[model samples]
Target: MYQYSEFDKQFVRNRAAQYRDQLERNLAGTLSDDEFRPLRLQNGWYLQRYAPMARISVPYGELSSEQLRVLGTIARDYDKPDAALLAEAQEKQTALGTVPVPGTNRQVGSELKYGYGHFTTRTNVQFNWIPLVKSAEVMELLASVNMHGIQTSGNAIRNITADHLAGIAVDEVADPRPFVEIIRQWAALHPEFVFLPRKFKIAVNGAQEDRAALGWYDIGLQLLRNEAGELGFRVQVGGGMGRTPIIGTVVGQFVPWQQILNYIEACVRVYNQYGRRDNIWKARIKILVKSEGQAYIDKVEEEFRQIVELDGAPHTITQAEYDRIAAQFAPPVLQRQPRDAAAQQVHQIIRADAEADPGYDRWLQRNVLPHRNPELRAVVLSFKRLGQHPGDCTADQFDAAAQLAERFSAGEARVTHEQNLLLPWVHQDDLPELWAAARKLGLARPNIGLITDMIACPGGDFCSLANARSLPIAEAITERFQDLDEEWDIGEIDINFSGCINSCGHHHAGHIGILGVDKDGKEWYQITLGGGDGSRAGGPASPGKIVGPSFAKEEVAGVIEALIDTYRQLRQPAANGRLETFIATLRRVGHEPFKAAANAARFVEKEVA
Candidate 1:
């Protein structure tokens, strides 16, 4: 993990103090709401549906145990709405009524939860109930740990994301964290690019697997070595999901690693100069690239040439600077011996446990990942479980995760793109003990890539931009798939649920996508199939195809069930003699069978006015 220098620490402190002054002025009526709104947004404060939401940047998904503890403190001490405000919000929620769970007499509860942090797909932490009045205090607390929410919101470059297994992945040709950190520093508050046509996101993947879902980012950089054995990047641009979902096109086959920043500068400059500003819907770079096609790439290439030939490539990364940053990411020293007597005994015990206990075996199969160091494993802490919104961790859970990280992972953790926490440096000998501890904390659920491990956003329950509530649908689907045997049988699947077209939940990347829609002021849902996040689970990066017209709210769970059943019935055995994945089957047979099943699953109901 990168440690903050004295200058870095002071910079954050100063920013916090500046925010306090701005917040106080806004409260004192010297600064109007219109004048203060952009300032607050720059500091990651948003006036959400019922309260203020704070998005804290976790650069490249890295966090130290100390920083995690402070996040826990923020959750416990500051993520609270005033009592009167909470009462008012609850009253409004009651007036909205509830969506009944299909085939049951029960209705989804309209409960408002606070005192927790939500880990987003972009590897940022969000608090939904933080009072705007106390936001300055919260910013100061974050600054103490060298953390902040700078550029996490607004039409600026957001936090840079990389594969959670960046440095430790076995197949990585080069570590992406150093570049990710460099980009984070460079783009944090660049004056010229502070307000682009729309918000931009960048993701990097160093390993062979596309763990960071690079194709869905505004800019996707994949580190690789060419035939000449020189390290470089394959650059992809214009990927995003909103009303328009697109897979980024590869514009640069291999740009030398030294000129990545320069190339990126050219790319963004073109978008900034030509991207639409009049229409909010078409402001994103994706829209520009889609509409312009090869012309966009030609412009970017011309800009790159101008930057390199005429401007002396000012942003080129020098070898010395790269080494300085890379040094911070050197593998942490381990305390355990791989072949010691105690290690052997633990290994034997693990083997015995796997032979005897299916739960332990399944946990190993799903959660434990291979590390570059043979003596260690990267372990995922599952957040997708029953009775809670996906990616949400209470104050106590945050503290417990910190403790676990300290005990097993060298005081470090990474927030995965799939909305889970990963202890990336756990010793192989400690798996049994770590599993037992994490299980006690309710963080160890062996459903990493299964049907139950769905991704969901905080929908209409919190986001003012939402068209419908995503939590109730997520909860209903989670309840429908609680049986461990059944979930494992369903195998690897990604169910991404978003409350609206903003695609915060990454519904366009899931094998099965559920998007909340509004029909004549009533809640409805649109289902899509065969979407992949450029991973083996769904194969390549592509947006899902909608099955048909939107269905009523109560029909979603049944439709999902019907789609899964359709897959189970039609799937054929693969070369490995295992049942083909839902995506593979759907792709082979096309969407008609699944669409038919989904429509048949709908129940007769009175139309809503």
Candidate 2:
């Protein structure tokens, strides 16, 4: 909810102008694809398999209702708004019974109206379309809305993420929003940090729950109070996902809140100067941490910290500035009355009509959350379904969600780290009517926190760096395990998939993690069990015993079935009976049996072949 300052506005406008110039040159043949590749990438443009894909950063996965409405308008006006567009165009062309003459300037049927836009697990939005001209138009439109595609796809600093619950969650000791905003401004287009060896990500978490997924970032800062009651951040460095996945090491302890930015700048300076640039694969900060050791990285960070501190903490933020940023994110006002009777009536109506509504029960459990205010509830809706690409909500769907939030939920919608949309402050009494409306918009799927609620990366489908197509495999697994009751029985599980070791889908943090790898030009998956997220004693799950080199795509469901069955037999009973508890139970039983069962499925397939 941070409003763009005049400085921010000018920054985006200048960048837009520069991009327009670069694009025009490329179109005019003044720049070759080789020359334009890095330039376009810095501007968030990519030429993928199907078309050109542009990634727009949605800083910290937070979007204002107005900003979201703008995105919806772009999708509707620019991209192929519906799947039926292509099919409908084909039908009309066939009706005409002949191809249109090539020289005619008149527009043909459905001639590539921009590209489809999709959300990624990394707090970014991507637009894919052919004929780069339309994509540029989309970029210019976004700039007018105070948004830009800068640094989203490059080796430059990517979107800065913070706890999604920042400012709203009462448990937070101190809001990290100010620090996040400060870094966002400083890092944007910083000449020293741009064009680093590899992509860099930073996250700040102020709550006990680690909503920012601190362990997966290059720089993870956990804001906390020290024993003396002074606010500070515990800094973790070199944690990243790629070919070599690592949970960051605690490099600096108790960096004072005011010195947070200085410490971060120091860390980046060290990585920028020393990080490998010769081999792209070995260039990540994680690799540097591995080769040079944490002790050495700590030494460099300490040196940089001293220099910055000596210069009177160049990035030190004042209390008033912090208040200004925090004020922008103040929680919306809530009604004091108890649950409205009319809302309860609607809930009953939907529950009673279960026979007529298949999604009703799922929506009730998955999409809705209890609020401290008796009259109000928060609705958490999953965009991740069995066959649909996870996190890919259409523009119209975005607008519909925004409208619903404005009408029923205090004019706000929250985007969750799990790639779901949230109506955070809806009145409990409105649940039934809200559910009914959400159902019509195709936002009523209720598989949240279930097996069907998968986290997936674009994979080989779009990303040039991926080894395999992750979305298709995720769809296959979801379809293979489509029974809602069975999924419910499995209970609160995190099943995450990544196209490669980068773990963009957060495979390293799932209760059940699946990572895609390339094996002799064939797509293979590596399964790791019992990973968890957050700041609790349980962090990223330990790398489980490798289950297989490869398994038939269809056999993945069977492999998971065998693993789940192993858990059922081996797990010790727990009071709450959560999957995490079951996983802990299995850890006690050891992983050998689970690995044996999962690997057995793959072995059988090899023999059949």
Candidate 3:
């Protein structure tokens, strides 16, 4: 984890002080709501559906145990009573006469109420309920952990996300964390681009598997090796999801590693200067790039030349600075477990137990990933508990995860783009103990990359921008697909939901994306098929194609089931009992089969699926 330098600490403290004064004025009526809106948004505070929400930045999704514990404290001490909203939603469900089983988590009023924050797909934490007056206190608490909401909102560069497996992945070409951090630092409070055409997002992926959903972001960088074995970024720009979805175009095939910052700066500068400003909906760089086509590239290259001529501008990151940031993220040294005859005898016992214990065996298969180090394995803690919203963890679970981080892995963890937690440096020998601890904390669902591990936003439940509730739909899907075998049989599915076109849930990136819309005051859902974050077999990531007509909210779960059934019935036979994933089948056979299935699965009755 990156340690805060004294200068960094001072800078954050000063910023907090400024925000505190700003909050006091807003509360005192010295500043009007209009004036306070932008100020609050700049600090990641939002006037949500029924309360103020604060988005805390988890830059590159890396944090230490101490930081997480503090977040847990914030949740327990400062969060509003979320039961008010849940109760309201329940009343609506009753009005419809659909008495679905209540969620298992009934501790709505518990002291350590579950969850440090709502983990978002962009790898940030959002407190859905917080008092407006205590906004300053929230900022102070965040600062205590050397974290802040700086640039998390307000049309600035959003938190830079990287592959959660950056340093630990078995197939990584380079650790993109350092570069991501460098970009964050440069883009933070940047005077020139503070108020761009609209909010911009960037991502970096180091592995062959594009876990970061690089394509849907405004700027996407995939670090790869050249023929000469030099590490560099394959740059993709202009890809976005909303009313109009397009896969990013290749801006630079392989921008040298050292010159990545320069390349990105050039792109940002070009967009800032020439991107649309007339229509808010069409203000993104994606639109500008689409309209201008090759001219966008020509301008960016021209900007790059000008910036290089000016010695890379003030935004240029030097080799020394890069090394300094990289040092902060250096891989941990591990004491490899001895693998002698005695170890083999011990391994026999473990193997035999794994064969006998189906639950533990399934967890090992689903939640574990190959590690770069031979003796260590990266663990994905399943935050996808069925009764709960996907990617949500209670405050108690956050505390436990913090303790687990210290005890089993290093004193650190990473947040995934899928809204899950990653113990990126766990030793293979400690898997049993870690799994047991996670099970107790509701983090051991054995559903990573399965259909049940859906990515959903707070939706109409918390976000004022949403037209429908996303959490309920997510909960419904999880409840319907409780069977582990069935989920596995479906195999490698991405079911993401967004309450609106903001794409906070990365709906367009999912193999099966559900977007909620307002149809005559009723919540309707539009489904998209065949879209995926990255390409199959190391190809380019493509946006999903819309599948036929939209369906009513009552039909969401059945429609999802229908899609799964379609894949099951129409997909090619499993090779070695491993079924071809939905995305792979779509790439091979196209979306017509799934479209037919979804149409057949429509809900004609008023009953909710």
* Tens-place lDDT digits, model 3, residues 512-551: 8989888877788989876677734223466677888888
Question: Which residues of candidate 2, in runs, are more than 4 Å off?
Answer: 80-115, 333-365, 370-376, 535-544, 577-582, 603-609
Measure candidate 1: CA RMSD.
3.2
Q: All predictions: root-mean-square deviation over Cα?
A: 3.2, 6.3, 4.0
Reference-based TM-score of each model: 0.95, 0.86, 0.91
Over 1-609, each residue of candidate 1 has an lDDT whose tens digit, in order, gives 897779889999999999999999999999999999999999899988777899999999999999999999999899887887677666766776543211111134534445789999998999988888889999999999999999799999999999999999998988999999888888989897999999999998899988889999999999999998999999999999999999998989999999999999999999999999999999999998989999999999999999999999999999999998888787777676456898788767766765587788899999999999998999999988887778888899889999999989999999988889999999887888888788888888899999888899988878888888788788778988999999988888889999999999999988999898888888889999889998767589999999899988778888889988998999899889998888889889998999999999888433321
Task: Give, for candidate 1, the lowest lDDT window spanning 10 residues.
Answer: 99-108
Q: Which residues of candidate 3, in runs, are more than 4 Å off?
A: 81-116, 310-316, 333-355, 535-540, 574-577, 604-606
Q: Which 10-residue window in model 2 sums to the lowest lDDT?
A: 98-107
**Model 1 CA deviation exceeding 4 Å by range:** 94-113, 337-355, 604-609
* lDDT, residue 378, candidate 2: 73
Per-residue accuracy of model 2 over 1-609 as CA lDDT, tens digit each: 566778788878788888788888988999887998998888788875444677887777666677778788776676542455435444543563322211111123323433245777666777654346666677677888788787687887888887656665556777777778778887888898888888998888887678787876788999999889999999888887666767787888888887777788788888888889999889888888778886656766786658676777767777886777777666677654554899667667775675367667667777776554566777876687653677777777778877887778667666677777777677766777788788777777778777777888777655656666666667666776778777766766677888777777888777778887777766667787777666342344244345546565446667877887777777655666544444575568777798888887664432111
C-alpha lDDT of candidate 3 relative to the true structure: 0.80
